[model samples]
Target: MGNALRFLYGGFFKPQSDEPDSLGPHGVTISTVGVSALAHDLSQFDITSQVPQGLSQHVVSSKKAQTKPPPKTPEDAAKLITQTLKNHEKADVEVHTGHLAFYGLPLPHTLVEVETSSTPAYQPQHWKFELHTLPVDAKAVADGDGITVYVDARHRTESANVPREVHESAIRRSKARAVKNYAEADALQKNIVDAGYRVINGPNNDDILVRKYRIRLRGIDAPESEMPFGKQAKEELVKLVQGKSLKVCIYDEDHYNRSVGDVYCNGTFVQEFMLKKGLAWHYVAHDQRPEFALWEKEARAARVGLWASSNPEKPWEWRKNRRNGV
Candidate 1:
């Protein structure tokens, strides 16, 4: 009986070569070749079994956990903003205090303290923050000293405050476009523009929503449209900024509710350009920057632009006369 058992074990469970053996049932040794053959045989069977209903559901839920819906509450919006900042940090993007203000978020304590501590150069004592605007359209130039700008809404805190009707209109516009309804989409876009917002093509050809702002160039006052050199001033400004982006450091809001800021384009100070070109006057009453007066003096000495008239009428004076029906 013992000899018969040994023979059976050697045939079925013993290692077939000098290779290591894999442990089988009851600590019995099985050769690799035998295991491979067994696996092949098992593969021939219906091994493509469906997962148990509960386990499959769990997997579907795990996938769902990877995504989240848009924020619907103030708390959720705040959390999303925090997450966005974190993501920006992770991507090595610079975050400025002014950027926070531009987003309509509260300034950080450190920034608030610094801002209140002392005045900085080229910035007014009441200076608020900077705004890096999107590209400006030719029609956005109201005059040499004023422009209508748009700020991207994707990262702005005020986006949370966007009217529900605007969002619904945008949604409808998108659906209309998807359905090839061009007229409906255009009409919806008109409504959005009337609400102080617009959808424009982004760098990647994607649609981007932006909010509007009227900006008044600080430090100088350009001639009125009807004044001498007025058309030239507007033309010069359009040539400088049409379809170009700008950096605006806001100081205050004017009576017209336009943001009064120092505008820079391609590293050129826009107010300086207008002053040096003799297209505008140094509005000393509003801004008493010595550089502005110096630029105006240089332009006057060169007898360029409005300075060619020797004693050209100022825009303010022109407006004053118009107001008095002179």
Candidate 2:
């Protein structure tokens, strides 16, 4: 064990020896003597000084006084400490705090407290967050907490999949159409089916409703499935909702799985976006016109996408004509 003492009242690390002791900031006399297998100089040292224990401290050198080394800047101290720790190949490290005099100078300095830990870097899992029809319009609502929900709906069948409730609900909704009851069950089946649910009637009267969403294609609204954009719409619908869990609210459903609900992807309303993007025209009979006023205005102003045609017929009108065998 090696021991070294410091005296900083005179602005340098003057070693304390057989001389009288001096007072420190705490009003205690700064003097120490220790002998052990693991004691170190508790004082900060000059970089020029070979670490104290490297030489013999037992010699009393009164003939020619040993002068202190140059003062160290905070940056120098930091670099020196880091390098010392890295290069200290021979000794087992032990540390202790020393008196302020160990600094050897009375300069008003700002000591920054730095903290370090050996923690692994964090990696966030990429997730999809979406919102459905809320009180606010799609344009009015912003992302990042506007009724957004996190769902792990995967494109492939995997262990880490969507919530069980989402899957089960989809299966149940899909299977409801297969049930033999057409009278009372029709409306219920339509409601779920229209809400982008795939109803499958299982054995033993069980039903599974799997959710399949849709995409709206650009241009030409064919009559439901026959109109130009009709198939494109269905295909787009599949892109938007199939294999993806969505928050949906239905006004009604066609005999097919075509739903009348507004769809949302990642907190953004797909239906409103489609309408605004001139992908789909507004459903006339279902005149919740207020909800789509902004989108209609946008489509009209752009004169792009589906609105390229001067006087396009509505899907309902086309469907009526088809039914009438015209």
Candidate 3:
């Protein structure tokens, strides 16, 4: 009776399978169902206890998260964005606030040309897209801080028509500035546009003298009507000094028996004004007044009067060409 009770108990507890079971001394062969049964039976096992003994540290991500964008102009902001993106090549930095997108690179040099945004949002604003002019060196100089830009003597003296003395004066002033002589430099720079010398003509029949004097513009060759803008130039000179009494200081005389000197009106250089108006060009025959070149340059930039054309023939060249019929 005892033997029969043991046999019945073993049969009831044994796993049931069609194949006979084979067990190794150190391992157990488990069927898919048996493994599932074992796992279900071990639901209370501690999963944390199964990790390898030497590797259990928590991982911390190295990525930096961005929350706000620095304030800047759309152009500047784009620069910052480009730098920011390049810096985070291996990761992402999200800029969730005030991020504006714009097109074009607008720095490090002059933007000679540009086109405005055609997008519907910007159309109503009538934005100024064209930069037809800038504060050119011959006419204006921007300040260092750029807070208050000082206009150069461009209004009356274009680069192409600036006087030689004026350029020498500017060089002296620039030298002063180089040495940090701020006050002297400022004074010298201001004097560049001031009338350099005076002009005087032969005395009138009356001892009192017809006027202060008659003076000839020292360096430039005013255009004659035969040349481009020649008539306009003569007309311009007539308007500036014809009836007006001028302060003349004659330094020399030209081959034409005319006094060669700088003419001033109320202490303002009259030829300087003419050059600024592009009424004449820097003459190389009598004297190559490169200083006046800047005055001409400024006029060209402004495209005023004679400089309005892309290529206005110089008076000398025009005369030579006319003679040669080339």
Candidate 4:
């Protein structure tokens, strides 16, 4: 007959004190016992003789063993659980003691939740956008920030309309100095022009002054000094402003050192008038005046100054094309 020896890891296993002893059924007796082969309940918890480097095998297991989960160390796991709670819709899981579990075993390895309250942080940087109106150089310099943004152009602000006498006095004062050979008179005339006003000289120096308001001729793109319409443009401007009163609004100067403004005579904008006369074309590139396009249409229709040419290019386009050698 063949003999078999079996060891009983009991209900109370003294892992440390009770050294490995051969087993009998009663009172820790050493004997040969027949191996009872019923399917050894493989599902129930069992204590193994194996122990980790720092831990002891005296560790206990119970029916409640399945209830107490092993410790979790992954920081990501905790974060994910927090996020899950934040986004929890149905509230299927409950938090017990800081450990999160669905049912009993830890949730599927992939399940992650996000915190709704904490959003990603972001910082916007300084950037450039187009403006409807050219920016004032002084403000641009002071702001020290990037250029002012505009949809198409800068919004024009309303201005006060000075009386004809005020303009006349300015011009007469300048002329009197010019007649006296005092340089102040010449300087006065220059100031008036720079301020978008003009002084008209009379026959006997006791002349009527016609000041055109809001005329930024210094910045307008007229024909070059020697160009056919350059002199005409100046003459035309003098004629327009000399006898007429206009509603003028001033604006900032551009890189070309041109002061841009809106000049109106009898509520008719002088820019529109000039565009129709073909004496000037649109001077802007990125930020264009509102009337730029409309005046272009009018000029095209009337075959005004530049439109007389078969394919007269706009000044901005011409300059750009010249730069690109196209």
Candidate 5:
């Protein structure tokens, strides 16, 4: 009985050691005198009755320790939800439903319905999607039909593809600014700009990193810079879009790799505006929209802008002639 008590005590409370124990073969070291005192103290208790209850309590406590604690804060809750979602395969629809139910969150009627509810539907077949650019600068308007614009990188689809070095440089730049190291920050910013990105001030005066895109206005051809009324066309475009955001419905990429898109600013269709003003041609060879033809005809009838000329040379024809050395 004393040996059994010693064994139980050693199993439960013995300090770990590398050396073999003198009193027992279980690596538990106890002097004879110490064992005598331990047995005498335990003699008062009903050992059989107490040991089972104590062992059961220890087992119960161990099981409780293994259970996960509930999240303590909103951020923690969000993280928990994200982790749970990541654990299941995306195709495990039934499992996801069960998880939502377990968490007492309302399940969506359908995944596709939920996804499409917030996103804009694509325009019928022709255009791919829309790009809402950041505010344009005066210098970015290269010509009447070409402009350079920046899109917020954070919101772009390819933002995740940013190089690790660029990200590191941005971080370093931020730290440099915080420490008032303007020179270092400027150098880092130059590197970011060289990589086709810019850190511009946001509406809240915070820095926003943006990716640059060169856009060619679709369905319109404006005169070359040296052509008659070309300066007026550029000025008109600059007046319309400078310092304003634009909605560009992208159709295709031109040979120059510029995004060919229809530009709209402040509820005005920019191409339509230019065509109606006779600042640009309808570019009928590339686009056959009847409204463009109608707008150009109205401008010609009114004798406004370049339409005031008895005969205006087409910009595309001019370009072709120039290229052919005509």
Candidate 6:
């Protein structure tokens, strides 16, 4: 260890010999601690020699300090964001806040959103997406007790590998999207086949329903986010499940990979709750359930919830009109 310590000392290494074969040092020496000489000296001893007892474990300093990583390119940023999302359990990631700055791509993403699963909150907690790892050139700011990240987006091409969940996010993002708009990523394409269901703690103590993946309450259609009662409907859904856990009967996945199924709290059908309150409509075109349509009728006759409107439009019609610029 003493020899090793001496070998590591600055004065040990001399400049290399010009002869290359000569063990003797050569070259115009400045400091006696040149690296080439140390190598030559150390080679004479047993290469596997152990460190002496009580030798300091502190790292010897290098002449040059390490350089910081290059500023993250939009491509690099996108990849990092995707990998970050992919590595975690979907339920664990939380994107509360952030913003992305597009770099070289001519994407409509000038206003693109990255969405994931939502953990419905009633009291408005200050936590959004709490990414386990931080991205480059981005800083996390303390915002109202939560964090808001700002990223500089700079990429030349759309990385096909990134998941849609990270890039073209939908309005109802999962917990993966607890984000405020700082970066992007892509979701893995997983095919579903009656994997089964699960229940978890939502923002409150309620039993939030889940399958192997996110589920869209089947046999019914709620207002689109832009529809008149859309915001209210979402708030209402959040409230309904606020202090409740759910029992889900998952049927299948929509074309978008979301689960479409029935939800029951205690013994009460959640879809029925939504309809009775006029928060949703029976989606007759895709539904196979018999009782759902019956509930819609009752809500309609009562003139309660949305049915109170003299001529309330079904949710699907509202969506079609919006797509057609109605």
For lDDT, the strongest prediction is 5
RMSD of each: 32.3, 25.5, 34.5, 31.6, 29.9, 29.4
TM-score of each: 0.59, 0.33, 0.35, 0.32, 0.58, 0.36
Candidate 4 runs further than 4 Å off: 1-220, 255-258, 313-326
lDDT of 5: 0.66
- lDDT of predicted model 1: 0.65
Q: Write model 5 residue lDDT over 1-326, tens digit each, in one string.
A: 33333433343223335533342211223344433443444453334423212211221123333253433333333333333323434433333343334323323232332221122222346888678888999999998899999988777564786777777788888889989999999999999988878788788978788878899998899998989989999999999999999988889999998999888888777887898788999889888664466567658878999999999998988988999999
- lDDT (Cα atoms) of all candidates against the true structure: 0.65, 0.37, 0.40, 0.38, 0.66, 0.39
Number of backbone collisions per candidate, in order?
Answer: 0, 34, 24, 12, 0, 33
Candidate 2: regions farther than 4 A off: 1-223, 251-260
Residue 62 in model 1: lDDT: 28
lDDT digits (tens) for residues 133-225 of candidate 4: 321222221110111111111122212344454565575676676579556666666766565444554446643333232124322355543
lDDT of 2 by residue, 74-153 (tens): 33333223322223322211110121223222211211111111111111131122223212222222221112222123
Give candidate 5 misplaced runs (Cα > 4 Å). Answer: 1-123, 156-158, 180-183
Q: Rank by lDDT, highest first.
A: 5, 1, 3, 6, 4, 2
lDDT of 6 at 199: 28
Residues 141-216, candidate 3, lDDT per residue (tens digit)? 1111001111123323234454777666666765686689989866765564345321112235211101111134
Root-mean-square deviation of Cα positions for candidate 6 versus the true structure, in angstroms: 29.4
- Candidate 6, which ten residues in sequence have the lowest lDDT sum? 96-105
